[model samples]
Target: MFTRIASALLVAGLLATSAPAAHAQTTAAKKAAATKAAAAKTAAAKKAAATKAAAAKAAAAKTAAANAAAAKAAAATPVAPKPAPVPLTESLASAGIKDALNKGIVKAVQFASEPDGFNMNDDIHIPFPEDAILMKTTLSKFPGMNTLISTFETQLNRAAEAAAPKAKDIFLNALANISITDAISLVTSGSTDAATQFLRKNTEAQLITAFRPDISAAIDQVGAGKAYAKMTSQYNRIPLMTPVQTDLTAYTTQKAVDGLFILLANEESKIRKNPAARTTDILKQVFGR
Candidate 1:
C-alpha cells in the first residue's frame, strides 16, 4: 500500500511539471504573434507614406511642365503695328484742308502738257539760278558754261518727262483724298496749299529715291558731270555775273513736288464744281452732299 501511494504521488508531480511547460509554450506563441502584427503595421504605414510622397512628386513635376509650356507659348506671340491704318478715302480726305487745294492741282496738270512743263517751266525747270543764266545765255558767249547749265536742265526735264506715266497714280490718289464736304468748301477757299503740303510731307522722301536713278541716267545721257566741270571753269573766268550753283536734282525734286500738288488741287476743284465728275457712289455721296 505504501509503494502504491508513493508511485501515485510521483505521477501527480510529473503531470504538474508538464502543465507549466505547456503554459510557457503558449506564452511564447502569443509573444511571437504580437511582434509579427507590430511589424506588419509598421510596414503598412511605411508603404502609405511612400505612396503619398510619390503622388506629391508626380503632381509637382506635372505642374512644372505645364508652367514651362505656358511660358514657351507666351514667348511665341508677335508685337502689334505702330500707327493704326485709316481708311484709304479717309486718309485722302484728311490730306486737304477745306476746298482750297483744287485750282493748284488743275493748273499744275495743265502746265505738264505745255512745252515748259518739263522743258521751259522756270519754277519747275532748273539748271542754275538766274544770276548764272548768262552761262547758258549762248554757247558762243560762255561755251563751257552753256554745256554745264544745259546738262543740268536737260537731265531735269528727262527725269520729269520720264516720270509722267506715274502721274495717273498721283491723280487717282489725290482724288481719293478729297471728300465731298471738302470739295464744296474748296470752291470758296480757292487755294491748293494743303495739297502741296501733303505731297511735300508724304511723298518727298520716297520720290527722292525714285528720281535718283532717272537723274543719274539723265546725267549720263547728257554728260552733265563733265558739263558741270566745264561750266565751273568758264564761270571762274567770267567776273561780270556772280554765278550761283545749285543741285539740279534738288531743284527738280522741289519743282516736281510743287507741280504734283498744283495738279491735285486743280482736279479736286473740277470734281467739286462738276457733279458729273464724281463718278463713283462714294465720291458722289461725299461730294454731292
Candidate 2:
C-alpha cells in the first residue's frame, strides 16, 4: 500500500510542471503578434506623411516657375517715341520778289513807330491817287506843313508797333480754322497763297479787339496822343486845308493787317519754290511738289 501512494504523488507533480511550461509559451506568442501589428501601423503613417510632403513641394515649384515667366514677359515689351510738328521753311525760301514788297510793308509799319518814323519817311508815305495828290501838292507848297503832317504820321505809327504782338496772338488764334485738308493742299500744291487766303477769311474780328487796347495804351504812353492833339489843333487853325477827324489808330491797324497778310502770301510762295528748305522728312514728302 505505501508504494502505490508514492507513485501517484510523483505523477501529479510532473503533470503540474508540464502544464506551466505550455502556458508560458502561449503567452510569449501573443506578445509577439501585438508588437508586429504596432510596427505595421507606424510604417503606414510615415509613408503617408512622405507622400503629402512631396505633393506640397511639387505645387510650390510650379507656382514659382509661373511667376518667373510673368515677370520676364513684362520686362520684354518696348515703349514708343513722340511725333513732330509741321514745318514752313520750304515756302519761305521759294518766295519771289513779291516777298520784298511784303518786307517793305513790315518796314513801313516799323518805321511808323520810331520818333521820326512816318514824319521824315517821305519814300513810303508818298501820294498815290490824284485826289490824294492834290492834298500832297497843297501840303508840299508850305515848307512847315510837311513837318506838321510828318509829326502826326509819326505819332500814328508809334501806336502801331506796340500793337503788333497783340496782333500776332490774334493771328495764332485764328490759324486753328485752317483745316487739315487745306493745309495738305497748300503744301502739296506748292501754293504760297493758301495761308493768305485762310488769314483773310478768319482773322478780322480777332484783330479788331486785339489792336484796340494795345494801340490805345501805346498812343497814351508814347506821348503820341499829346503830339497828335497839338498837331491837329494847329492844322485846324490852317486857312486852306480841310479839317480831318480820322481815328489814326484804326487807320494804322488796317495798314498793319494788310502788311501781315502780304508777308503770309510771300512766305507761302517761298515754301512752294524751295524743296530743300523743307527741314523735316514729312515736309519734304508733302511739299516736294
Candidate 3:
C-alpha cells in the first residue's frame, strides 16, 4: 500500500510539472502567432501605401503629358489674316499732297542751302552758262584761264546755295495758294512726281519772278558778279573775238530754279515709292498701301 501511494504521488508530480511546461509552451506559441500577424499587417499596409503612391505619380505624369499635348496643338494652329484697308478719299489725298510738297520743300532747302551743296551734287551742279560756251572754250586756251573758269563756275554754285533758303518761303506760299481740284486723280495718277509736277507748272513763273532779286543779291554776296565781270572783261580784251554778251543773273536764276525743282521732284518721288520716306501720318496714309 505505501509503494502504491508513492507511485501515485510521483505520477501526479510529473503530470503537474508537464502541465505547467505545456501551458508555457502554448502561451509562447500564441505570442509568436500574434507577433507574426502584426508583422504581416504592417507589411500589407506598406505595400498598399506604395501602390497608392505609384498610382498618384502615374496620374500626375498623365496630366502633365495631356497638358503638353494641348499646348503643342494650340501652338500649331494658324492665325487669321488681317483685313484690307479702306479706299482713299479726296480730303485725304489733298492732305497727302500738301504734306508731301511741304516735306519736299523742307528736304530741298536742307540739301541745297548748305555749303558746297550745289557745287558737289553732279545732278544739280551749275556749269558755266550754255551761251558762254564760246567764251569758256576760248578762255581754256589761255594760260591760267582754266583756274579762273573753274573758280567762276564754283562761285555760281555758291551763289545758288546762298539763295536756296529763300525758295522755302516762296514754295510754301505757292503750296498754300494752289488748289487740289483733282486730288484723287493726282494721287492715283501712277506718276511718282505728279504733285511736284503740278506745283512746278502752276508756280514756276511766279517763283522765278519772286526769286530773281534773292539770286542777284546772293550772286553779289558770293562774289559771282565780280567773277562774271572779270571773265567778260578778260574775254572782251581778246582781239577779233565776237563780244560774248550773256545775262549772268538771268542764267544763274533759271538754273537755280531748275535745280530746286529737280530736288523737289526727287523728294516727292521718294515719298511716293519708298515707305521709309513717308515721314508724316498723312503721307503714310496716302502712300503706304
lDDT of 1: 0.59
- The total of clashing pairs for model 3 equals 0
Candidate 1 residues lying further than 4 Å off, grouped into runs, are 1-117, 120-128, 137-155, 163-196, 223-226, 239-244
Expressed as tens digits, the lDDT of each residue in 7-100 for candidate 1 is 9999999999999999999999999999999999999999999999999999999999999999998889775666543343543344433233
Q: Which has the greatest lDDT?
A: 3
Clashes per candidate (backbone, < 3 Å): 18, 9, 0
> Global lDDT of each model?
0.59, 0.58, 0.88
What clash pairs does model 2 have? 90-271, 91-270, 91-271, 92-271, 94-270, 95-270, 119-150, 192-268, 192-269
Cα-based RMSD of candidate 2? 21.6
Ranking by TM-score: 3, 2, 1
Model 2 misplaced regions, further than 4 Å: 1-143, 188-191, 239-241
Ranking by lDDT: 3, 1, 2
TM-scores across all candidates?
0.44, 0.50, 0.72
lDDT per residue as tens, model 2, 21-139 = 99999999999999998999999999999999999999999999999998888778664565454455444323322232233334433444455443344433312222334454565
lDDT of 3 at 248: 83
TM-score for candidate 2: 0.50
